[model samples]
Target: MVKLLAILIALCLGQAIVAERIVNCYWGTWANYRSGNGKFDVSNIDPWLCTHLSYSFFGIKDNGEIQSLDTWLDYDLGFINQAVGLKQQNSNLKVLAVVGGWNEGSTKYSSMAGDWNKRQNFINSALNLLRNNGFDGLDLDWEYPNQRGGNWDDRANFVTLLREIKEAFAPYGYELGIAVGAGQALASTSYEISNIAQHVSFINVMTYDFAMASDGKTGFNAPQWAVEDAINYWLSQGAPANKLVLGVGMYGRSFQLTDASQNWPGAPCRGVGAAGAYSGDGGYLGYNEICLNNWYTVFDNDNAAPYAYSGDQWVSFDNVLSVQWKMDFALNKNLAGAMVWSLETDDYRGHCGEAYPLLKAINMKLRWT
Candidate 1:
């Protein structure tokens, strides 16, 4: 019993240090992690990676199975509430539920906008979920707010949603956050970022997927230059530096070239993804898949980006070194924090593996300077 008590005390102290460290939870749900154990094993997983376990809550279908965002809320409340209880019993792990995503789009948000009653219902539902489920906060991954299929009417409505959510969550002491795209086009089309900045705790910029063309000749998906530009634009547009959390990709993009004659400069191959296959959807492949297929080799410099090439296939993806560069950028600029995509894809065991090491380095650095 004495030994057990000592171990518990050590764990409590560790958790306190972890909670104050940087926040790095993956979207925690997608094609890869839609429905699984709902609990990630943080034992081998880096505490930095699993420090904040964010489960996605997006299922917008009809036919009334309590799906969509509504049912997703119940799902998180049920599983995560229990998880939080476990967190208290065992200690460590501050979990959150993310709403909406890139594929599901932001239609529900559009529908809930303008109407005060419906808006209240949405906000109340979110707060209730956090209260019942044991979530530390809420992340609004609305995919997009303006642009393309997004309704212009929902522009101001998006702000309203943030305002309502902030107000509702404030009383209950829940954190409010949003995932934004990382392009000027997004800034132009999405909700009023400047207006919404001060309200939410911080903004997670989706700073990857630059152009998504699978052809190996394309530029970096989330180039450091591009990311810096996006952040500069946001801050120039009035986003508080300390309230911005840069987003990094734990994946890579691959492309194949047609032939020597057709190969574009820096694009090593004829096409990308599935080996010479064309994807109208997007040409990029993730880092996990890249390693799994053994299609591309990673190369990194001090610039905070990695590049790889295989045969006619050539691609550039970000790695921990590049990520550390960005972290330094965040620190120098006094930004809030940084976050990665889904945690499942990180290179867990390899000479090139860096997700955990880099995260630990960041936590260590934050502790000092």
Candidate 2:
């Protein structure tokens, strides 16, 4: 009888803990200028639905200082302040400034993290930016630390940088997070996971882009197996499961098939698919554009993902069903939460059946509502 009572108490405590899981979403600063698609800005964001909103990117200068990727959008036009103002709607919402992206490259991060003086300079700049911009924290989006133009010692240096940042941010009650590669090969090579796990508050494991146009094949961009493998590997590397947030792509990878008849996973492909309606990027389609276009949908039961093929174009992306599956996976793994690639890609305008269907599916599965 006593043991049964203890079990009930623990279950209640677990429920209380789960109630605060992070539902982080990245809001792209450039989505406001998507041309053909209507503008998507901070005003369009539903702050209440997300516990944390990270502004997509800030550039890292060679001098280890953080700069705006877009001067106008980030500061001259006041979008940064507007994003931070979202806290007015949901007082508990945290707005973080994300620095570095694939395009930003790792040369600057490598130099900054490798040197103590440069690392301190960068940390100071980050704190200043966060304070001036009204942001609650920083989210490092460095593509890599020890690879992709970085040095061999970058793995250890990256952890040192994070620890310094965390130490500096602690007194101010600021949060620190990182967006990391989900592939086991990249994770093992680029990160000192055991050391890193102790510094950052959470890690956003990027599980998308598993298959790209460069691969010359058609496959689910973010397969279930890859996601599970990444989570498991991180856990094995001593990362606490509750501090890992699974990343879901709100966009799809596209490919132009060499032969329409052979359009399937691992089939030969010529190049990227034509430009998407909203994303305006070749070989990629945002969920908004995917819903707008009429393509024959194909489901991969084994991978728990969906793909679409039309004429000679093939695209792999996530829909409401797949997002639910990912959320359930997070729950089963006792993960910290789930995060979307970017907020602008979703059907935020209610054009695709319901507004924010992908995000809503995540909320439903996680019971955030």
Candidate 3:
């Protein structure tokens, strides 16, 4: 057991960096419903794998109040209770409840933020959710402010919503954070970065999904250069390097090649690839499924990212090395830390060999300085 003890010591030493950095890991509760080994819940999570655990995603009501999207999974099954209870095991763990997600849409968020009484209603409900659920804070994930069929005033109103939330959260020592669109095209239209950054503790920039299945072309889901560029753009827009948390997608974007031999990036795609046995979802593959396969993998020279293909199926994702590279990039730039799109998507099962390999890789990169 001496060998194992020594190995554990080495791993523990690397985790020292997270104390000053933010390794925010989102736990999408939907994973509990995934089939077979695909299922992941509070019991399966390693508390030590993250500095901050965001329980996604609480929904927004039409009247601008906080709502639980899955009442049974959150309340009836005790996921929220069990999630916050983890702080008992890890004193440093900060569990934040995220409100709003891509599926929640911008219509209600726009209506809420754009109205005065609704903003207060939202704030009061947010406080109630935190205090009632024992969540340390709230993560407002409005998706986008002015886009997605939202109002024109949403750009400024989003900041107003954050300003109020920040004020309300202060007296109670509750932290406020946001997950924003990262690309220039999206961020420019979606946020007032400088102002929004002033109110929240951490700016979780959603850097992944730069290329999706709908693009109709093969591309990296979250390329290293793309991530770097997003970081640079946020910095240029006055987002503090120390408060920025790089968002990493723990899954890959996949597509079916229009032509068998045309498998390079930008290759025409006929449609999304077949669903994975474990992921049970089309157009995306969890690292657990991808790492175990022997698909031919290629590294993009310009972006320094990797992609794998089997016949007509093509996917772009990060391996351990690519993840570490981003971590190194984050540290080198003095970023607060990196946040994964989810904890469930990582190879948490050790189906290949090591459990939570992506999480471990990111854990190694969690340095504040």
Candidate 4:
């Protein structure tokens, strides 16, 4: 009996070795595609930033067709073509499309899953889009699975859809990936990560955005300790380290308020504005969006998590230095790679060079290996 148990342990360890062979870093890009003003440039993608680059396919109408800010654009295949061309030039770069996001949420996931025909149609379209565009894989960003905000009802069924898509994409040699929420609260209540991890090449844990767009508590988007805790939970729940990629926020949240609420004081200011009530942004003034542009500012140290304050309004946003810390942590933990929320948010042209700094630092640290 003891010998049999040893054999079982060995086999399990071997399987784990295989599962964690690849690490991925994900970045989201909804504002870029739909920003309309062209303030952000996708063409400026730094191939050396990470091994893989990903963008979100946002503003997708209910029916599965791609929609732009002003027009029902046909399947031009221009962006994909351009992105693919860039990848072909750089052997180290791999691009993937991230479908669904926080704003769009998972509202239509169940509906798409329930109707087999629709699901297949969507899959076919996505696959074709990928193939024609020369994308290496597809990353599903379905915010939540069994949760309610997006009116999702078929959590198990959604997994079934993933199974089907993986089977379908296999023949074409297209890899499948997924982005999920982090933290114990989300882990216990929302995603079935352990059962689902085996199906994808990597699972991206969105380690940031903890405070929320509506809060007064200033904090980093993705704290390292929080990330550690979250990673430990997922691993405990059966997620392989190699198949797990840590997420870091390239941008910071900014808020605005009077001196009446000087909760967290002496925080750095790249510039201040009323955006992302729980985070920080520069020159972006006034509280016009969803949340309060509250009373806090945040920053993270060797940990990816951030802490901050603005008069009484406090916020925490991770700069490139903080992101580097998390990347090192991921490497130290023997995890796969990192995934950034979106590419456009980083200071590709100017604003701040946090994103580039983090990516460059990650490469520098990994150079020895």
Candidate 5:
């Protein structure tokens, strides 16, 4: 019905852009486990920063019931209540719970979506979970419906699940969205774009995590035109312009340069770069960690993104300038809005002088004076 409403709004307004553009933000609950500046609680979030806040990675049981991944911290410790309570501060905020992330895998989702009786049970459980917990709705994050250890029938059944979920959500005025894969080949196999887009309130196209080749070379995690290309592909496949939201990653993929002299795209890498202090994960660095570095940064004019290199370490990530380019592309395409993968990674500590710098860049570009 959200799409229908958008169509009505566009028709009445006599313009291409419909309703309000949303900044859908995802919050990883595990960030609370990180020590020092890495520790991010639900309360640390500025409620007004995002139009929609998704509490990510609530698990699913064999019985199709939604389970908090961290029962102790998320539910018993009141993290769920704390996240929902943000709505009290900003009445316009819509807090959603995400089920079936990359870690959850496709087995549970495929099993639940394939069976008729199970889908209804899942819907009932999801609704009860949301209404009882004071959440605005659900954002299904099944990584890939048909692939990743799932059955062949999943491609069609996933649509049925979404359709039923959207129908069930309509009476309660709950929003239903999905995090879709951005790769061309993966997207074709995983989703029936037009069919699924019909049932969703919005589609958060995950336009990052790009790896160029298997040649042990380095590449930008998300290039500006690559994001635009994903948007265009989805649109061409019949997804609605207003229901599509472009995704931006708040982290960078780092690689250790094999020879310090060759420090550009396709340059050979020894392996993952040294771990960031906060993230403590090799091959990855948050914007908070990346921006604080004194590395020599170079911009890729063709891609409209930046990668920094110092010594044998190199990382490709979107800074404010590249983020602006992405948002501009979204605007030009008449897409709904922008989505940041997770709020925790994007310079949230103010060590870079301002907090949520990349997110603010998205908001600044998407919002007009």
Candidate 6:
């Protein structure tokens, strides 16, 4: 009995010695415009729940200058100030200004990265914005470097851009990160993963959106298989396991089934699902709406994901259970941590029994005491 007790104690001590993993959450500027109960502002955030908060997004201008997509909220309305001010409550929290989301497109990024002068100009612009706004770092959300309207050379030029940015950020002790695609083909072709990893502080792998309305088939929004494949591919390409952060979707992708009987995965879909109550977007529903609405929840043991069906509409999203599974997977793989797409989509109001339940699950699984 004493020997067994000693072994258990040793294991407990070993766990306690492990460093805490990062919980990076992305906050959308447009979430302030959400109507009704779903609306979210910087004040809605719980600083203690996250180690880092990435503000999305800042745009790249034609002249390779960095600009805020929403100047009024990012500057005029004092959102940036208020966001950074959260550090007072949680001293360990870090805020990063994210640049180039999907809507910003890749045309300007390609142009900026291709030319030496343009790349320097962009780096300088980004540094100025971060320093002026009191941000601790910068996150490059270039969408896809070599795909999505970008040139083939982007695969190589991306590494150069990150190297320059890292060099510039070194003296100031600023952090640099990038968001990468989650598919094997997209990740391998769009990123020189090993080279880029050497420069950036971390890589946020976008593991959601595996299935969409246009795919013509019903499936999980972010299947477990895609997550495993993406992470393994990055690791194989020499990305440090400690610098890869898994991306979790805070919303669900909805699909309109062609026939009610065809509600299972791989079934035919006619079109996108109906518009959400607060998100105001067709074919997508935030966790807030998903929790309130009544649907028969079905867990896909094979995919390690969950989907819900009500009438002819089917929505696939990550719940507390699935999020926990992902967190566990990250721990088992010795990964750096996990990040959420947008904090606004979460059930932040406690309407779903607890405030930020999904995020809470992450915190618990990551052993953040």
Top-lDDT candidate index: 6
Question: Which window of 10 residues has the lowest lDDT sum in candidate 6?
Answer: 13-22
Structural similarity to truth (TM-score) of each candidate: 0.78, 0.95, 0.94, 0.75, 0.93, 0.95
Q: lDDT for model 5, please.
A: 0.88
lDDT of 2 by residue, 84-166 (tens): 89899889999999999999888899999998888888999999999888999999998988778998899999989999999
Tens-digit lDDT track of model 3 for 25-95: 99889999889889999988999888899999988888899899999999999999999999999988999
**Stretches of model 1 off by over 4 angstroms after superposition:** 1-21, 30-45, 48-51, 60-86, 89-93, 214-217, 260-271, 275-284, 291-304, 349-358, 361-369
Q: How much does candidate 1 score in TM-score? A: 0.78
lDDT of 3 at 361: 85
- Show pairs that collide, candidate 3: none
How well does candidate 4 score on lDDT at residue 101? Answer: 71
Model 6, span 1-369: residue lDDT tens: 999999999888876744367789999879899788978998899998898999999999888889988889878999999999999999989999999999988899999999999998999998899889899999999988877789899989999999999999999999998998978888877888889999999999998998899999898898888888888888998999999999999999999999998789899999999889999899999998999888999999999999999888999999998998898889889998989988998999989799999988888877554
Q: Give the winner by lDDT: 2 or 6.
A: 6
1-369: candidate 1 lDDT, tens digit per residue: 999999999988876643454465664433322223222333324543445666666443322111344444344435444445546643556677777776667665666665677777667666666776677887888767765356887778888778878887876788888888878887768868788896898888888887455433556777777889898989888999878887777776656655534333354454554431211123555555455456444544433577666555656676556777777777677777777785644544432554455455455544333
After superposing candidate 5 on the true structure, give the runs of residues whose Cα lies further than 4 Å from its correct spot.
1-19, 212-215
At residue 164, candidate 3 shows an lDDT of 89
TM-score for candidate 2, please give it.
Answer: 0.95
Q: Candidate 4, residues 28-85: lDDT per residue as tens digits?
A: 3334443332244456676655567675563345665333322222135355556556
Preferred candidate (TM-score higher): 3 or 4? 3
* Global lDDT of model 2: 0.89
Model 2 residue runs over 4 Å out of place are 1-15
Write candidate 5's Cα lDDT for 206-232 as tens digits.
999886334499998998777777888
lDDT scores in order: 0.63, 0.89, 0.89, 0.60, 0.88, 0.90
